[model samples]
Target chain A: MKKMGKERPGQPGMDRRDFLIRLAKAGATVGVAAGVGYFLHDPFGPRASAEKPPGVLPDFIVPGVGKKIAIATGGGRIKAIDGAIEALGGMGSFIKKGDRVLMKVNCAFASPPSLCATTSPELVAEVTRLCFRAGAASVAVTDNPINDPESCFSLSGIGEAARSSGAELILPRESLFTEFTAPGSSLIRDWPVFTGAFTGVTKLIGICPVKDHHRSGASMAMKNWYGFIGGRRNIFHQNIHTFIKDLALMIKPTLVILDGTFTMVSNGPTGGSLSDLKKTETMIASTDQVAADSAGARLLGKTAKDLPFIMQAERAGVGTADFESLKPYRVSIG
Target chain B: MRRAGVLETCIGVFLLTLLAVIAGGVYWYGANPPKSASGRGPGVSGVPLGVAANLPADLAPFGREETFDPGTLSDKIDGKADLYLSTGFVELTVRRFAKKTDAKSWIELSVYQMRDSAGAFSVYSLQKRKDSKPLNLASSGGGDSAYRTADAIFFAAGPKYFEITSSAPGLMGDMKILAINLVKGQPRSGGLTIESFFPHKFLDRSTISLHMKDVFSMSGLDRVYTAVYTDRGCQVTAFISRRKSPKEAEDIAAAYGKFLLENGGVAAGEMIDAPGAKIYKVFDTYEVVMHRGAFFAGAHEVDKLESAKDVALRVYRKISEVVR
Candidate 1:
């Protein structure tokens, strides 16, 4: 009878205290396990980073660092056109006769050049003239837009200048793209991109307008590479900074021209009101995307301290932020 | 009086013993319930259920350029994928590799139920291969979801996939998920399918394989089961793999064939026997397709094993329709 009581079916023991204690223990265990499990599955974990071969990390870092072209931050005088060409060694350095030169501009935002959110027409025209002067080849300007392609180009000012300067305007599609790999990026492994536009080019120029972004706190040279992405753009917002670095790792641009003629101080990448526009009148150019962006940030009265991404780019050895290291040549552009 | 005290002590001991047994039973039930046959339900939102799940947790929260939109889940394991928002079910999908040192200890798969502030159903957190002993392998490669996210494609909304790679200094494993957009209980485009898809645009010239060739002859599916032969055979010369699930096997083959075709191999033809068997062949020493219910017999070359295993998984991925 005693044994039967011990094995008693429903209420094995009449006391509820022990049941409560076990429940508490189970809850605690599950909670700890949940935390550990969640952390272990983090995307930055070893398994994720292990996917890309070691060759990928330095691959993005090399051109990013080597391409640092510094513009004059002294005297407040801006050299928008000559500064860009000169930093890339006067166009003769890269463009040769019969070489196909492709220039990728950000026409994704439907805004004019004065807003400082779109690539300036003057910047595009100067690059085109430089390419034509350097070679007996074709120079084409185009972009993959998040909005209507033609409208973005025509209204943004890149389309007219590109056509007049003897550069063809191409729309982004599958035909323009090819695949490339990010060697050591935990986020990006290998992906397809605009191949013909990016590959085998004697000279490639990046024209990005400095703007404020809700996500990265700022949009500059590194952020502009998002336009070259072939298939998907929304996923970039998932892990924005790591991917920005990854994209920076892939695009080894010869010149990163910041069109700071009309700086978008606050709301940007698409500023509706003219209130966000400020007359910074100073266009910064550099072979180092990091340096140009850093200089541009300083002009806006914000230092690299506020932007974690700029600091990150600098740490990754993408470019120089120290104004002292760069030889600035101040020239007035009317 | 002493006798009475002993009797009372016995009853108290009996009650404690009974309580322990009941508590243990409850613990066992909570820890190990029969897993659902088809696994947990999909994301209630229109997003793909397993997009992030497709990539290893370490390879997730990847956003291209300046975009780190780690889908709708913002817990950081793979960098900073912290800005996700959704009102439906979300989950993590962890994947385990068969060749890892601690593969057995890791979570083969797990599910977590999520709810929004309204206490409504939100995300189904699925974690695959969640636990494993620390590996001693050197660094090898990373996953695609992070890079894709970094590049700004919402891969978490694309397809359910995973990969295990071992490179020079390290070995790696990952799970990737395709985002799901639920439409009246159906899935959006780009989700996984259970049927073999046409590799090339033309279906008539596709390769096929079989086991127990005579069995297909008896079953009258021979017209459907095509056969081919190559130089290598078994585990040494050919490809052999054991998958954890039918879905996994199918996914591997599809992805492998895609890789091969993309890399420059042509689908010359296919061979078959019983669904799964002991013997297998390598058509080009670079590729092999195993039918359902097959075990590889020998070891294969190191260079070709990866590709061959991938093709085998692809075959398994699309093995749902064996209609007579």
Candidate 2:
């Protein structure tokens, strides 16, 4: 063990908090190395490609892959989840062991599996299990439920699913929020947020249900981050598109998973009527929140142009809108 | 008889033409009243006197009286004491300017020392009350000076008791008279005798503002003092209390600067040129202020805690003088 006073090469006056963050990152890096599947590399720079063919690229630009999404389905079940995952390499491709993994699942409504108001419990569980298997040291599954958390989690089956999948459920409460200063932001400067276990964590994954929203037209990946903010949620509703865009800039999630298996056609992030459900038989996964939401919007037969938040998120560089670069991999499941 | 017949004929001829034109003019006037008449008042045609004669003489003070008797007033009348709901999420209280029929004498300003359950009297309302109607003047535009009510009371003895009241709604329980004075003469009418004094010089390190704490959220300085300054004389004289340690007082002095710089009270560059002075520490303090200069050879330690306190007071007085 290194002495506490022995500072890292570049650190100056590193306090206990900084030391802990670095220690966690180091532990995660070592654990990922031991897992020996895919490797974690800094995403801020151009990544060196693995010894794989062009057809089975280890990585694709996050924004490019999000625009058009595809979930493999065959014989009424998922046949190639691992194949789709392998296409972009493996879990090790993005995350490392000991990384604080925060999964944002859709628990917006108190409806059963068939209602489509929330992401299907099966999809959420699969994502949770995959993240744990990927060497995530700590997995925290959370969502800001519009309905009561207990009812929403139970009826949507997310609570049980997250538990069984080895993910801790983080209920949205004021106690979980912490103050963050966003410099240069006009509407919000110092605001309170739940701070998706991501700040010091190695990776952040957005697991959101594709649904229609009253204010911004669509509640997709970018809008999902709004749940993390507390104190003044109503202020965001005043100008939702700008708020969503600003939130996307703030969140900067590592990956986006659009649970399009059952898309809410209307009256959501909380839907009630039976006619509001639409079965897309698809799951959109990408690194770009904008592109993932754009594809999710398209699943509902709505264009990115129709969803103002998506356009704003895209304009803010949260994702891309151009369908050509989306690079969708439509796989068949069993 | 011939002259009377001619006069009758002229009157009849004039009446016939005038009647035809008068009817049209009256119709036009009915449709549009002249704009000048509309501009004279609120044009509502009713005195908005608000709640009339319902409030107890003690709580509402309907007529001019030496003292208010709370027992006679209504217990919980709606909108008591003529507090008008104002725009911008605020309400304004009514203090009928103590109508002194005599021109020479002004009403005495009275600072009500509201007594809490403990019986200690303070000028401000420390707690939130639901519906108690005490003799409190409500106000809006949430600024409170440290001794503004005190000063208002100080100058009230002369003649014009600026019918002062708390800036909050509802009653303030039982209140006793703390201090009384008239502000000599109306400062507006060549009467500028009323002055604030602070014995210390360092107290002027920060800008002083007279405002309420809860309303402004502890953002502004609520310090008050008075002193006359000459063009060539030192303006930085300050005072402090004897109780606190010199080091502690110095830290307190630095706190004023910290607050000013950190909380947008004053620009960092602006503090360099502000002047300083030394004086005896007591109830109030004074300081000399310079908008663009240095002071006290870079804020050193003075002799005693009292001296330090005096400096703090002086700083406050200097700031108050500059602000005033």
Candidate 3:
């Protein structure tokens, strides 16, 4: 909880000379307070820049966790999702009765699903349906899009899919964000987080498509957390790897779904040409984000060492980079 | 009487000051009018409102045109904003026309005005691919470099980059006619004449490309022109770039040499016949790089060292002739 700024007192019918004097006095007071606050909270000061908010813990860890990852292949997106979730011991293993599940989907671009820049709406609908069938109280689909929020959601067809599957669509608004601090980050100190959507959410799931990123090399489950951050986040591109590692440590997701049904091979993050896409027809469900991203990197013809964030996250003790050692359950469906 | 005189003088001064302020306001308004309020016509700076009139009337199309400056171009082509921004985009005019005969048959024409010819060439060159078919039109540079897809045609003339995409197939002819008209409507600002340095004897017109930045995955190597040539079942890629100075050109050529050596390329020593030219064997092909004056030229992916030397010397001689 943060205090609001003090409102300026109205000075009706005041003379111009008197008003100027009052404004000068107020300005001096604000300048002194700001200087003192800066010394106390400056990112470059002796004090630690990142601080975790109260009452928030890593919610991604499931009790009695078993297999680390599941890889499903040779099916459409919906089938692949179902098979992957089933291999991980079904949706019931994660979502219990009356649990509010938040599905953070990759709707970064307003591109149609055929472009393979966003998660498939059909997969979102199926996941929502499965969550409800598993006795979840409610399911919500949300993302802070790179393009216009409403247009990205609508064009990607995720909005309609969530509605038909009885899930609410949450779009980020300016007023809905709250300032958040990461516990141990070099870049992200105090930043805006869409806290309104996370209210009362018991379990969190990330559904993102594997695609080439112009800056980060590849975008997967770990990179999907970028949508949860607000403000002029584009500046983070200067230090993309560090920001991504910080993001991995910020949120603990119950499960992550990596959509590889159609992976964008080149000019990605926002692919404009259909030629840039390659059909891998695969999906992965995992409890370890670093392991999931490592698998996604391999799909892009890269190793975990190739992407700095993967290794960085691994060293940060967020998850494991040795995805093969996790012994991911592999299945093929017609 | 003295007090009355002072009052009159004050009133006169106030009236004069008011008059000056009004005159200044009028001048400022004229000089800084909004883009929409500017006169609409056709040219390098004209914002044509009736864009459909510029098209062939037989197409029977309804047109909607919008103009954007650097601040607002992202609202239109959000996905490709980075590409346009990198090219020094100044203004963009987009016209969407749908055929009245069949609404499904439509075309969109986008004209991007860049800062200069280099900027226009950058935007045009980045989109060029090896498979794009040549489109012959009567624009600047003869429009011979224009490439067409099944539904889109892209070309650049002067500091203007043009893209005309149609919804229906087999609109290549119509797109060409439209491009010619667009070129005819605007004043000629000149084309990238440096492209002519490549020899015409063995040049593959379809394979000619300009890379604004990062040629051969090497960053900071900007404004590079490349073309492919085939002779006796051997293919060669010729590249040329103009740098700020002779020293810069030499440094870039040396950097490329080092990059090749670090990436599995073996040094094959200098070409004795051509002074200042180095040869290397890289990935089953003979590579040669040379610097002449402010221009650095190279030939790569040739089957034989002699063929590589032949193309490299030719480009080297051409750059010397053009630059000198």
Candidate 4:
């Protein structure tokens, strides 16, 4: 066996023992300096108390492939939903046989559907029926509302529609959320996420209504995922554009459906008066959430470039802001 | 010699271990950032902490008060004031009073303390609409304006903006009473003196406004006071911004001019008489911007270039005199 500090012959340097001594002395001096420097200037000390941990991506996500968006206009909610989804291929294209489907619907407020603040019950019911007809084993409807969950679901008429359509209305309970970490995100780290609806669910669908948001410019399909967040998530609004883009990165849904039957022109996300709403009678279905929101913006007389979130999401490689380039299928349902 | 060698080796190992410990500490801190305390707290900027005590108790109402720092303001307004966070928002206090008889019969009072009066006015003006009914309140002046809806009253005074909302009918009287009390609690200060610099001739009093954040959708311009005027069958708007320094004012004026040129406006050959003022014609309307001392003023949407320059120069002269 060779000695511990034995040097090989023909090597042009000090003996192994001498080299080891010098290296140890140099390392010791550097390490002591580094330790003192760390004490003097702790670069990674506690951050601002208001700063939140990064948001977490969903554990199970359905990848989007060859995504297409379809816009159906000139019809009631049910007809528009049908025409839009059919144009995107069909219900069978998203929901497969024996799949457990989870529908994330926007029930942000307890207001009735006529106020256009929440998703229309007729549209939710029709989509539930379509999923079941496509051979989905179970369809669960869920939302973490801004108002009281039970009242929001019940008064919004979404509860009755889900029950009558043979779907389970999953109300978010305190125990249902789990702390999740979204790695490599400046915002939304170690946040509470509603995990109850994801149990045994193989497919995910997002249903949202287009409306003018006082902060985010507009709330569309991408904003629909805000329902999955729990706790004091409103703090995310401090950087509304980044939060929206982070949401797009967090959830990868099978399909995104934008309900524009009655677009809220102003004072929205929670419109109180009927005068704030306009009957656009439109629906957009797409596999790409960013693309769906880009098209939905047009219904509110805004372009993709007008919203910071849409541009940010596009730049983040989530989807394209040039939604027109996708050559969406346009239909008129009478 | 052998003992010294062993001592050096041990010291090196000890230092290396200490460095590792420090590195681990940093990583742990980065991984787990501190979180704000989750509950109601005292008011910011030495504002009264007990908001409920200041309110009338005989209203037969139950009250709750919450104070929010700039980072957590979204919690107070449910994200409604997210846009204002960029404008130097400091803190906010929200007091909610609800009658026991009906949950819908409630009053929500919010007091926002910004970095300065300019920031407060910016948030106030952003929320104001042209259709709202103007209210004559004791605190209305110096970049302060009050407007009311059937159930809501919004006003700004000094470094604070107030919002009083009620779901109950016929609460305007109560709102006014609350406003007077709120003004009493605030520090007395002069109104936005910039309003006095505008020429009263051809000025429309009702149209006078101070845009806190941006003017006409153009960014980098804050604390801009604007008023409309009727001149020879044409309507024109004159705006002025009092910046911290002349250089800063000049930069903003230049930025506004560049914005106009980028947005389909053409630079005109005839310049305004004021030092550093440029004229532009955009969409059949003339626009002019100028800077004097710490004051930046401009006129936009006039029918003719000469008329726009005339308004711009007059406002610029007035601001220069005030600065002098």
Please name the candidate that would achieve the greatest DockQ relative to the true structure.
4
Ranking by lDDT: 3, 4, 1, 2
Lowest summed lDDT window (length 10), candidate 1 chain B:
B119-128
Query: DockQ of each model against the real complex?
Result: 0.01, 0.01, 0.11, 0.21
lDDT of 1 by residue, B1-324 (tens): 012367779997999899789979976985664321112233342113243334333432211111112242221111112211322334443222222353222212212222221111111111111121222111212111211111011111122221121111122223222211111122122211211331222222212221211121222111122322231443222323334555665554555555456655565444343243222233445445443432222212223544444434434343423322
- Candidate 1 TM-score restricted to chain A: 0.73
Highest TM-score scorer: 3
Candidate 2 C-alpha lDDT tens digits along A1-334: 3346766774545667666877897899788866653453334432223332222101223333333344444333233345455555566666667777777776765455655666667777776777788888878788765324665687567888888988888887656655654433444444666754444455677777778775577777888876666553554566778887877777766677776666776545544333456666666666667777777788778898987777776776666876447667767665
Comparing 1 with 3 on lDDT, the higher-scoring candidate is 3
DockQ metric, candidate 3: 0.11
Question: Which residue ranges in model 1 land beyond 4 Å of their true spot?
Answer: A1-79, A83-89, A178-180, B1-324
Q: For residues A1-334, could you state the per-residue lDDT of candidate 3 as single tens digits? A: 1222443465334555555776897899899978976875645633222464532434656779854899999888888899999999999999999999999998876555666778888989999999999999999999987335875797678999999999999998978777777678766666777878888888999998999886788989999998888765666776889899999998899999999988877756765445556789889999999999999888898999999999999999999999999999997989
lDDT score for candidate 1 against the true structure: 0.48
Model 3: per-residue Cα lDDT over B215-296, one tens digit each:
7877777778888887666788999887889999999989999988999999988976557889989888888988888888
> Chain B alone, TM-score of each model?
0.19, 0.24, 0.74, 0.74
DockQ of 1: 0.01
Q: Estimated TM-score per prediction?
A: 0.42, 0.40, 0.73, 0.66
lDDT: worst 10-residue window of model 3 chain A? A1-10
Residue-by-residue lDDT tens digits, candidate 4, B1-324: 134467779997999899799999987986765333123443352224345455555344333345677655544344465656766788876655655556545566778887877667666665564456777676532324677766677877788888776645755676776676676645543546777888887887657666766567886566778888777767778988788899998888888888999999998855536767888888899888888888888897788766677777778778877777
Worst 10 residues of 4 chain B by lDDT: B37-46
> Which rank order by TM-score, best down to worst?
3, 4, 1, 2
